[model samples]
Target: MKKTLAVALALALTATACGSSDEQDDKSEFAENGTFVYAIPADPGELDPANAVLGATNTVLAFAYDTLVYSDADGKIVSGLAEKWEAQADKVTFTLRKGVTCADKSPVTPQTVADSMNYLSDPKNKAALLGVLIPAGMTATADEAAGTVTLATKDPNPFLLESMTAVYVVCGEGLKDRSILKDKTSGTGMYPLFTSVANDHYAFKARADYAWGPGGAKHEAGMPAAVQLKVVKDESTAANMMTTGELNGAQFTGADRKRVEAIPGVRKGSAPDGIGEFFFHQGDGRAAAENKVRGALVRALDLNELRAIASGGDPVPATRLISLAPDPCRGDSVTGNTPPADPGTAATLLDETGWKAGTDGVRTKGGEKLKLRVAYQTSAGPGVQAGMEYIAQKWKALGVETELVGSADAKYADSLFKDGDWDMAWVPLGLSLPTQLVGYLSGPGPDEQGSNFAHIRNPGYEQLTAEAAKKVGASGCEQWTNAEAALVENVDVVPVLRPTQLVASKNAMLEVIGGVVRPTSVRMLKN
Candidate 1:
């Protein structure tokens, strides 16, 4: 039987059923290749979704796990493990899809779903998804007899499901002992972990019995029997592999995509991705805490020029944090919100803020010279390091000393959270909805906020998001947009540019969705 995927996600809670139909295709022309070769920028350490904070981790692990709800290319929630779900101000009810099994072949019940929720909601577990997607004060109750799991949140969360796309549901065995996640696999997803080679590659085998997937996507003939993530750090090496068909797909962010596509038997998978930016650390003792200082630091550079040289003009200055397809509040929040770079205004702002210019051109407040430490991840690419240095030079021109430091790939998260070493940093965090950023903006500080790396505390934003959370979908768009605008206006976040992520595949044979390669969706014709 063939059917079209659901548009508006059907909600079936408590004795009801979501009337979703599957669009089936006869596996006549589609070919099942022996293996699908993939190349990524770097190894996102550990497969454990709970402790993994990197976006690359979520993007890769998504192929190995299933969420409660799935999203379309446009960031709209469809259905995943749960047939349909109902959301409320503080409560969410989910109706489980029967016969879903874990990667280990264990039956997934309503209780199994409840356990995953409870584990993620616990504050002590330190799950990165906490407060980012699941929220802070969350609890769940499972009624196996009714086949429903009700999740109770402390407050209104309009975009919970949209954010939940990052919450990869796992079984109790791995949930209880998260350390096993580094070595073991457990989830009712499309593929299971097969073998992993240190700093080199990871292989996964497809599951035959699995059926639940985003928008009811299921395994078919063209789906690869196995998938390999080959970690090639160099851009040219990965690009050359894509051209040679040694790798089926490789992620390309810069103008290098053109070079790859220039070779025969190569096509690009293009989509919107979050930008690179320097988030101001506004916590106490942080140099960029004051709004005026933050403003000066942002106004010191011509962002267009920096992005041009750094990213090969492949990036668009961000308008909104969530730039995915089908976004409800899709508009230019960055244009009017982000001001034009003005060195004159920057100089003036610094002077008015009690920082007097010294003979060395560096400003001094009392006796201490105004110097800011800007940290960025080396793993982001050489372009990021070059861009940070460029911005640092621009700051020096404004009579402010800037220290451009790069964190090693291993200590990326620690430099921001553990060490408290950076005064400013380039960290791009994106979600499907505006409300997803609420927790990161109006939080206490980084030590307390699981996702608020900036340590931002905007009181007005708190009020706006609280009010908006009471409404759903576009009903709350204006409020959420205004709240984000406040962050830009106050110089809490000065985005360098939004990235237009591009990937190259051999002969355009692979179907990558939302910047992820789901094994279930990939089609390979027999060569």
Candidate 2:
């Protein structure tokens, strides 16, 4: 029987979902075109949800896996693998769907979902970013008879389901060997990893024996047949590939948007989030790494020029450590109206902090040159290099020496991050959950299995985040407000700008969901 109710709901949303566009010529490489080629900025660093936080990796892998719950375009949580859930008192019960299998042909179970969340919650795991999604003392349990799983938390976590999107469920068969994720990913998703050409491309084949998709899902068990994600890091190449029909969809910057749409058979749409920026390292023992200096650095940046160099003129300067999504962090309330970019102000701040300019105009304090070794991840691409160099020049004017390091290697970058070799760095921080920002502030940072990349620890800031996590969602307003205020008070990490991510798709493609906290099931219809 046709699910008329589900179809009607989808049709209702079509008004907002259907994007306006100028048609472009569509080309393809498949036999009668059963394959779709997608282009993104980077390759999937890892398929493991517990470790892999890159947008490209998650976006491509989402079709290959299923999570406990799903998030909508507006950052709201809805049901996914689970049919329905009941939250009673302090315990929550989740009813699982039937006949689900992993990509490797393993059965899905309540234990599987619970085990996956547990794995992500473990502190011993270095790459687990999902740990910050939940409260510190939450336990997950499985009930076989009811096909349900229960998560008991010490306190209320209204955004628990929203956080579950990051905890994508996997096969429970090999829970002991976590290394299976490094090579193979097992989940009850639409696509399975058929081939992965590292740094080049990856191929996913639709599961023939698949079932158990939610009612709102656009695609059923196996709709696309085969999904291909190509790594065309260059914007021009990706646009060219999309035009020639070698690729069906690609992520485009604001700069590429005009040119991409100018070609026939292509359309451009905006992703609902903000762009990434340079996260200044302001931890202990670093000379002149004070709040005044951090604020001064932000003032020195020509945000207009930065935005011009970036995809669009949309420069949402990160006034606070938190993201630009919520309106509470904007305007003169946090960052005073017109941030001062005066070199005199910056030099004066450094001078008062004991840093004196040498003969070379580079400041020094205690016989140590005030040159900061700003190391941006080599994998950040050429556009990032250009922006970093521009910022480097701006800092030089303030008598501060800046260094730009490039490499596509994450391991090498991880080594630098661990050893604290970077004075200031351009790192992509995944701040989906509100607490994730707090975790980056005072919790055991990424280097210590926490998100605190700045390695900043303040008791006051830590308390604010802790209090906020106790009540998420609408109720978390006070906690988040206080925490955000505390973070900005110190100016521990100066937020350069928030980015509105860019995604591109073929003319035949029906829809592309943007601003997703975690990659789930996104469908491209046969338009």
Model 2 lDDT tens row, 12-106: 11112112121333343213225766776677676776665555666665667777766554445567788788754345678888776776677
Q: Top model by TM-score, which number?
A: 1
Tell me the RMSD of model 2 versus the true structure.
8.4
lDDT of 1 by residue, 1-527 (tens): 00000000000000010111112232335555568788866676878877555444555686688988765655567888889888776687889899898876778888888888888888787666665557788888999998888888777777665656657888847866778898556888887888888578888888888788877778776788888888887778988787667887776765476788587645555555555666888878766888888888778888788877566567567777664433568656667776578999989988998888998888898799888888877756667778888888898888878788886644656676666688888875544567656655665445753546677878777888888889866778888888778777878877667665565666225544444664566666554
Question: Where does candidate 2 have its weakest 10-residue lDDT segment?
Answer: 9-18
Clashes of 2: 19
Q: Pairing residues by index, what is the TM-score of model 2?
A: 0.75
Cα TM-score per model: 0.82, 0.75
Instruction: Identify the leading candidate in terms of lDDT.
Output: 1
